[model samples]
Each structure stands twice: as C-alpha cells, then as structure tokens.
Target chain A: MIPAGPAGAHVRHWQRFTFTERVMRSLFYIVVLIGIVWSLQSIEIIPEFLYDAPQQTADLFVRMWPIDWGWYPKVVHAALMETLHTATLGTILAVAMATPVALLVARNVTRSVLLNSIGRFILVATRSVHAMIWALFFVAVFGPGALAGTLAIAVHSIGFTGKFLSEAIEEAKPGPIEALKAAGAPPLAVLIKGIWPQVKPAFLALAMFRWDINVRESAVLGLVGGGGLGMALDTALSNLYWDQAGLVLAVIFGIVIVAEIATSWARSRII
Target chain B: MDASAPIKPPVDDAGVDRTLIIRSLTKAYRAGQPVLKNVSLKVEGRGMTAIIGPSGTGKSTLIRCINRLVDPTAGEILFLDQDIAKLNGRALRQMRRRIGMVFQEYNLVERLSVIENVLTGRLGYVPVWRAWLRRFKARDIERAFQLLDAVGLGALATQRADQLSGGQRQRVGIARALMQEPDLILADEPTSSLDPKTSVEIMELIAKRAGERDIPVIVNIHNVALARRFADRVVGMSKGEIVFDGPPRDLEDSHLLQIYGGEGWLE
Candidate 1:
C-alpha cells in the first residue's frame, strides 16, 4: 500500500514488458521474417529461372482442362485399384516387419540400452532415404515393377511405423506391466497381456495413418519406375497428354480421399 | 503394546506352516544409493500382514521384491522352499503366476472390457494362442464369472474399464487378482486412491478373501488406522528398515511415532 504510486506502476510496467511484451515482439519479428521469405519464394525472386517458368505452367494447365470424362471409369476401376493394392501390400509387409523392430527400439520394452540404441539407429537410417529414392534404388536393383514399388513403400513405412509404434509402447501405462510381473507372467506374457492391450488402439491407428500416406506415396513411387498409377500419370505428362494427366491426378486424389475417410472411420471404431 | 506379541492365529501355528522367509534383502536403483537397506522380515502364511510406514520408506519395494517385480539386489526370498530371488526367465514367470498383486490405481486396462481384464489374470495359465484368440477355456470363463460375481461386478463385466467409478474399478482389480488363484496376495496401497468408506470396504474384501483362501497377504499401507483395523501382524518400517513387528493390538502410539518420525501428526 505504501508503494502504490508511480514507482510501483513503473515496476509493474517493467515486469509486463520483460515477460509478455518481449515475447510478443519476438513473435512479431519471426512472423515478419517468414512473410518476407515466403513472398520472395512465391514471386520466384529467390530462384530466377522459376520467375520465367509461368508460360509453360499456364500452357500445361490450359491444356489440362476440357474434361476427360470418357476415360474416368477406366481410371477409377483399374488405376485406383492398383494404387490401393500397392498401399495394402506395402503397409501389411511394413507392419509385419515393424512389429518386432518396434519392440526392440522401445527403451522400456528393450531393457538393453545398446540394443535399443541400435534399433533406433537402424530405423533412422531406413527413414533417412525418402520413399521415392528408395523406389528408384530398388527399381535399379530389381528392375521396374510393382514389386520394387511395394518394397520401397514397405521399407519406408517400416521406419515410420516402427518409430511411432515404439513411442506408443514406451508411453503405455506401467501399471499393467507391473501387475503382470507380480502375477508371475512371463516376459512374453507381459508383452501380450500388459503392453499389447494398451498399445493396440494406438498401433492400429498409426498403421492406418501409414496406409493412408502410403496410398499417396505409392502413386508417386511409379514416377521413379516403381510401376503404378504414377507411371501412367508420368507418361501422360511426358507425352503432353494433359487431359489424361488431369484424369490420373483426379483418380489419385479420389483414392487418397477415400482411403483417408475409411481409415478415420476405422480408427474411430477401435477406440 | 508389546513388540514381541504373537500376531498370527493359533490354528496357523499347527497347520502346514506357509510362511515367506526373506533373508538379508536389499534393493538399489542406483549403484551407490540403496532404496531398501538389508531389509528382512518374515510374513505368516495366513491372515493379513500390513507393512506400515511413511512415504519413501521402501514399503512398496519390499512387497514388489517378494515376486521379483523390483528384483532385490541381494538376499533370498524363499517361498515354499524356493529361492525366488535367484530365479530367472521361465522359472521367474512360473513363480510370478502363483502370486497376485493389486495396485493403488486399480491399473485395469481402460480400453478393455472388465471381463477381458479379468481374463488377463489367467494369461500365464492359458496358452498364448488361446489368449490371442480370446478363447479362454470354458472352466476359466465360468470361474472368472464367479469371481466377478463374488466381487459384486458380474453385471459390469461387459463394460469398458474406463467407464467405471474409482471404487468399482478397484473391485474389478480385486476380481482380477483373485482370478489368479494365487498362493500369496500383495497389495501396494490398494485403497490409497479411494474415499475412506471405499478404502475400508476394499480392505475388508482383501482380508476376507485372503482369510477364506488361507493365503498370506502383504500390504503396504500409509494409513496406520486402516492397517491396525485389518492387519493381523503389523510390521513398521522406517528409512528402509523394520523398526517394529508384532500383533496390530500391540502397535502403540509410541511405535507409530518411531515408524513415521515426529509426533506432531499424532492425536
């Protein structure tokens, strides 16, 4: 009460400035810098050649219009099916491989520090190479086919699925595990009864999410000779058949949307 | 209260004496610092033995060590003439299946139905493929139903565990433990999360079940009143060491003061 004056007001002002005001100012500067960088990139000022690339892009888009409704049925029935099959086979193989690797990577489950570290490093190595690059490498090794694409997607999915599964396993409640141990449940029994129950919903959700992403990625893997709809789209684009390219893009988009909806519905039912 | 007063029932003395003999037990989380320091205490084969102490006194560690959950750094935990402390892998798992534990939080898998959680108690007994298939033996299922009924949770068996009240979940937890047909029951602060009334009910259930089965029970409890109310024998721990062991009737206010340290909380 004695210090309820201008001096106290000054102290309160400084306190406000040090915490809230300073943070606001820092955020403002970061936003402004990001905006500037984005503007430069968008206008192609940063990459001179991009600035001169508009005429070609516009021509491509103009040629893409004038609907290819005649071929829509075939694209949906065949190409979309191929895409789904690639995603399904890829995700199934990945989930199978990831299951054991995830257990080894999880620090809580693994017990051995060296083993967990090694498993994590392997996952990191697998994930480091992008799926498209993996597809290209596999295509070179096995020759251009759906197998190469499937293996590429599976390898990449393994890294992602294993990392997420391990995290889910690690974060599982310790209560059941402890209870299982006290019950004299074997390590395998504990994993089955204690860990699996807690992580099942999350694991399934992650796997579904990976499958959704794989559907989108599998279409792209074909661009690198891993055969699928992306191969059709790439060939159409290369031949300047913009209407066919547009059809392929629409089909890919439709498949992705459908997969996302289906996976989301499935995930909701699990939990 | 006399520190040397007999705690166990007279009939237990003459029967096939089933006692847990813990000798020179020690546990340390870190290399230099020990959580349980050369702790050793015998538990009678029948009735409830409550280990009462203040927080951080290794009460939970001692109970966990009985089934090798905490894994003692040193000592022999001889249960039925077998050194559980030295057992590993399959032997350890076989030993664990014979002992049951209830937790303070109930620890039921929230996503699982109550019946599924109860069946988990039989996981060690059932084959892995059978468990994976959710094909519990008909007898086991019938026994689980009976146990759920005994716990007054038969009606709620189909509900998910997360849907139950705290007291109800603890009841399910009890049913799950009892399903194991354990030789000994370990309850670590099982009722600490419940209201006073619920706590009493849970403790009464634990005491009654253990008594009916003539199974030994080791409970780590912070509430001295609760411990005194249910415990046949009271083992008072302080700073990872047993300071007093005797009948609950013999645990005087002075002993409580020693076990918990300071008399400010005492009425």
Candidate 2:
C-alpha cells in the first residue's frame, strides 16, 4: 500500500480498527486457539495411528484394486435404491411438516409472541442436534431399519427447511397482502394467494438445496444400522473386504452426484 | 345512539337513504395521542368526496378508519345498514367484500400477470381451495378480462405488473378495485405516485367509474386542483379536523390558506 504524498499526509489510516473491534479480533483468535488445543486433548489423539494412516490407506487401496466389477451388482441391490428412497421420502415429509411451523414463526404472518417463540424453539432444538444423533434416537426407538433412517432425516429437515422458509415469508412484500385483505380475503387465503406468490421462487430454491443435503445425509444414516449405503460399507469394512467397501462408496458417490444435478435442474426451472 | 351496543345491521328509519354514516371517529396508534380526532361525516347514496389536507394531518387515517384498516378509537361507521366498527372475523370479511380500496402505491402483486391481479379482487368471494388453484367462475374470468380492456391494458393482460409503467400499473389497480363489484370505494391518494398528466387521467377514470355505479367514493388526496376538478364535494382538513365542507366551487384562496397554512404557496 502506497502512501499518497501530501494529499493524505495529515489523514490517519482508513484501515484502522475501532477500539472494541481491535479487542474483539484479538479475543476471537485466542478463543479459537484454545478451542483447538482443548479438542485435541479431549479426543486423545493417537500420534502413532495418525502417522501410519496414509501408508495403511495406500496399501489397502493397492490390494483392493483391479476394479471389483462383480461387487457392483451386490452394491446396487443392497443399498442404492434404499438410499434414494430414504432421502426423497424424508425431504418430502420434512417440507410438509415445516410448512405450518414456518408460517407460525414468520413475524408478519404470526402476531402471537408465544406461538412465534414456540416455533423458533422447535427449529433451534431440532437443528442443534445433527442427523447422526437423530438416527441414533430413532434407531433405538424403531429397532434400526430404513424406517429409523427416514424418520431421522425428516426430523432434522424440519428444523433446516423451517428456519429458511419462515424468514423468506417474513421478508416478503406486504403490499400484495394489504390489497388482498382489503378485498376481504381471509388469513389463510392471504397466506396462499397473497404471500405464496412472493415467496414461491425463493422457497423452491431453499427446498431444493435442502433436498440435496438430505441425499448426502441419508446415505450415511445406515452407519447405525438404519440401512443404506453406509450399512453396506460398514459390513464390508468389518470383514476386512476393502474392495467391497470401495464399490459401495463408489455407488453412494454416483447417487449423490445424480441427486445434486437433478436438484440444480429443478431449482433453475422453478425459480 | 349508544356507542356500547352490540352493533348489528341497522334498521331503516324514516325516508332518508344513508349509504354510510360516520359518527365521532377517533384513532390512536399510541396510547394517548390520537391521529384522527372525533371525525364524523356522512355520505348519502353516491358521488365522489375528496379529503384534502397537508401531509401528516390524518387525511389517510380518516379514510382508513372507515374500512377498519386503522381501527377508530371511538366511532360508529355504518355502511349498508351495518356498523363497520364492530364486525370481526367472518362478519368483517363479509363486509369487506362489499368495499374496495385503491392505494397510493398501486399495490398489485408484481410477480402475477395483469389479468391475475384483477382477478385477485374476487379473492374475498371465492373459496380458499378454489383461490389456491386459481379457479375462478367463468363469469369472474370474463369480468376480469373486461376490466382489463376498459383500463386499455387488454393486450397486456399476460404481462407481469412490474413490467408496466407507473401509469399502467395504476390502471391495473383501478381495474382490480372495480373487480370487487363493490358498493363503495376508498381511494387513498390513488394518483399521489403518478406524474402530473397521469394523475389527471387516473382521477378522471375514478370519477367516471363512481359516476356509473352511483356508489360513494371517499378519496384522500394531496392535490387540491385535481380534487376540485374530479370531486362532487371537497372536504378540507387541518390539524386532524375538518376546516371546510362544501361543494368545490365554493372553495377559494382563504380556504386553501386555512387548510394548508401559509399564503406564499397559494401564488
């Protein structure tokens, strides 16, 4: 950065931070440094295992190579269909359940303080816990299967979709709503006819983005034996069949790519 | 008349046909300071009545109060043999269907097509499910198209509202209000956002519509010239109170001075 001669000679540097901002910046770095150290200590990092990981991974891959084409049919039958079904069903259910909650939480739509706070609380509570933890809860409740996987993803989605969608509704233009209500449209009608049009494009984008995330999340719900590609991968890993595990991972990757493309296409069309 | 009575549809008394009767209406957005203070006016049958005042003098508040958009702190708004001040829920909705409102901003849903916005005026009369599906009766669709044609946007019916010019959008707004098939119309400075020429055109259109219907129109306007030209009666307000109430021909510089204050602007 060059100092512009006498023109700005008497002027102080514009890049200077305020007193509080300077203090906050220093404090943030210190807190992050402390967190990293604490996490490493708490997890009991094994230096020896970490050092050997790369070598072990390379050796395993070498033995598993020569393309396990025979394992492709097994992977497709075992987990591909289940993975797709779980994600699609979970996303649909989650969006459906989130719709009412989103409306109640939107400040413009909902005037009640209690209801708005309750809606916010549900979103916060659900979102704070990840899909993995939700899978564990449903696995224990439903005895572990595709049912548990679907329910887990759906529950987490309620929080995810609700938070974004409600904000969109709140930020929507109030002009159309006033026009509709003045014409004697009811509250529900105001939502569907007046508010819906304003938020449809934004909501479509948000839902499609969430659906893509769910596809990735549902693939691994089977780690807890909820039944998908993750469960098949787990089985192959346990028996030390690295080639079979590689095949299952490849299938999961293919499905995720396909889902991502489809969602992108759908989002563009609607928005 | 008792103010505390459970207000219902009023029974016809004597020979006078009152389309709307307002008595002692006041509004306060805050606790003690009222924006509209004890405003009372009556409209018999039809024709346009323009309310003119300085900015922040509660001209908009007065018109909004009649439709219960801004609930009056103390008032009785009798329209079509019913007390508008007391209706709630379904009853209020039913009453609103009979009244149409035009805003200064011309608040048509920008994402919707011109014709679709005109049809929105019938939203109050249709079932919720039917409205969601955009299913209007054949008659309503036909009327919506006719209104678009009347507004001279017949070819632009499929165009989005945001694509139209300010003048064109206001025309769509006027068409939307007429779509309600309302018994009364409340226009809140319907031309305030338009250019001078467009303003004149809008006022003329409104006068023509109200004249044809014989329904009363209570308009809150800022332009004295436009109001006088279009209104059957001109109402001048100052400091949230009516200062002048008579025909437009009777108003002069003295009345304008009193309503808006300061003599320099009159020249």
Candidate 2's TM-score: 0.90
Model 2, residue pairs in steric clash = none
lDDT of 2 by residue, A201-252 (tens): 9888987888899889988888897778888878888988877877877777
Window of ten residues with lowest summed lDDT in model 1 chain A: A7-16
The deviation in Å at residue A151 for candidate 1 is 1.2
C-alpha lDDT (0 to 100) for residue B130 of candidate 2: 81
Candidate 1 lDDT score at position B126 = 85
What are the lDDT figures for the candidates, one per model?
A: 0.86, 0.87
Best of the candidates, TM-score? 2
Instruction: Give me the candidate number with maximum DockQ.
Output: 2
Summarize candidate 1's per-residue lDDT along B117-218 as a digit string, tens digits: 888888778888787788999998998899889888889989989999999998888888888987788999999999999999999999987788788888
Across B121-240, the per-residue lDDT of candidate 2 in tens digits comes to 998899988888888899999999998888788999999998999999999998999999888899998998999999999989888876776657889999999989999899999988
Q: Candidate 2 — which residues are off by over 4 angstroms?
A: A1-35, B1-18
What is the number of residue pairs that collide in model 2?
A: 0
